[model samples]
Target: MAKILVVEDNEDINEILKNLLLGEHQVIQAYSGTEATLLFKQEIFDLVLLDIMLPGKDGGQVLQEIRQSSQVPVLMITAIGDKQSVTQYLLNGANDYITKPFDGDEVKARIQVQLRQTMSQELAGSKRQEYGHIELDSQTFTVSGPLGQVSLRKKEYDIFQLLLDHPKQIFTKEKLYEQIWQDVYLPGDNTLNAHLSNLRKKLKEVDDCHEYIETIWGLGIRLKEWQSS
Candidate 1:
């Protein structure tokens, strides 16, 4: 059973969610955004059910903070159903969302979907693969080299994996964003760039002397040719 963190300010709603998920999963409750953040840092939960309207930091702020350090699945709980609001939540990294006065079965279904996806990714590649001196352990979601090792967030890992799997193949920003985010790429969207930048930084930390990813000014991005001293 997965461990889930439930963050909601309304006592009644929080209790209802706990009751619904209790038998199938372990649930932790947080009444305010501040408390949710603190609990999240203290525990490693498989999923988070965060309410967009909260007392302390609000759901948007909490989501931003979580994305900074983790790639754990988060299902937003929002009363707002407008297209713009939902779009913002997804772009900000929520895996999914449940509207207020939600149907119990629908909530359960959405949660299951996210959990299943996470499990699938975890079990995708059991063996380690390498390029140059850098190694990727799919099971552990980590990359290591002679210099050091570091764990990568989901997006960062996916970007690296795609490039490593197809060395020398250039992937344009649009292609990368679509494949990684599973959404249409939008102009001026910095999501892919930010993740790529973070991935490059981690690779540099692992092996500083040789670059692993190369950016072709007008073409795209590809794995750098492995060079040996």
Candidate 2:
């Protein structure tokens, strides 16, 4: 079962979502955009059900902020006939949209679709590996941390996966370059660092107990040992 974060402000609707999700997965609620962003950084969630008319920061703004730092799937909840709102939110980066006055079954179906897509994409990317205090599920392409598990973008996890796949093996930048991006003919040096930075930051978020990735002076990187240097 996946962990879902419900970001709706309405008490009745929140209760309905709670009941709808209770048996299958863990669900947490955040009533405002501010709360959602804070919880998002503090913990991992599989999907975010965001209401467009939320107080404090609104759905679009919250979605923007999340996309800036995370790739978690977001499904926007809008009002009836709110085509403009849906369009605007999508342009703003929502994974999917469900209108207001929604049927219970429809809500569940849409959520399932997004979750399924998220899972599918993950499975296609990562291969089984253990990095630091984290576990990577290659079949599902998800990463599990101390708090819970969450999905990651391909490039981000691929970099970490490579190091973990061969723990303590020194992989030069060229080797890592060949493995992850498949070629060194494109974005250049800055590109690799950008992805590595993202992986390191996210892994730290998952488990702050240790640093799993270690840079090897002027050569490359290696997955560090769990107990000691």
Candidate 3:
């Protein structure tokens, strides 16, 4: 099971998503933009179900904040979605999106897709990294920990594979966004934090020490030499 953060002002939608997703994953809800950003700074989540029309900071602002520091997958939730709105959020840095009155099965499918992608990235390990316990055989596209194995989503595999390819070097969020997401914006958001949380969690499941991912404080995150195989 994975952890999800739901950022929406409407109580009804929050409850709906909670009920729909609670069966397969843990759900955390935030009523407003402020609350959502707070939870993001404090915990790790696999995906974020974010709404655009929110109190205080609003959805756009909240998304902006998240993108600055996180790389966690974000799926924008909306009531009034259009081509322009979709383009705006995508350009701002959202992985996927859905309009309101959506199907529960569709949400589940999307969530599963993201989770599976994450699982894949974990197994792939790092580039040139044939580590113990956690083995990522890129050729076969399989990630096997001591316990089991899984496949990675396209985006997750791309960014994670890049890090594994260069375990020692620190790739700034801007660089990562450009390299992975293909763009950059000012001040940044928690997008990097979101992705890091997922990355760290995967590492822990296979290797509790999780030394492969190290935070350099203000600089960025990278894998430790001793931790890498």
The clash numbers for all candidates, in the given order, read 0, 0, 25
Pairs with steric clashes in candidate 2? none
Clashes of 3: 25
Model 3 misplaced stretches (Cα beyond 4 Å) = 125-229
Candidate with best TM-score: 2
User: Across residues 39-140, which tens digit of lDDT does each residue of candidate 3 receive?
Assistant: 987887889999988998888898888886677889999887478978889899888888888999998898788778877876676443466457765655
Residue-by-residue lDDT tens digits, candidate 2, 61-120: 899888866678899988848577678778878898877787889988888888999888
Q: Which candidate order results from sorting by lDDT in descending order?
A: 1, 2, 3
- Stretch of 10 with least lDDT, candidate 2: 180-189
Q: For candidate 1, lDDT tens digit of each residue in 1-229?
A: 9999999999999999999999999999999999999998788899999999999899999999999777899999988869799889999999999999999999999999999999988787476998888899888789999888999987798889999889979999999888777778999998888888899999999998889899999999999999886
TM-scores for all candidates?
0.58, 0.61, 0.57
Worst 10 residues of 3 by lDDT: 124-133
Candidate 2's displacement at residue 47, Å, is: 0.9
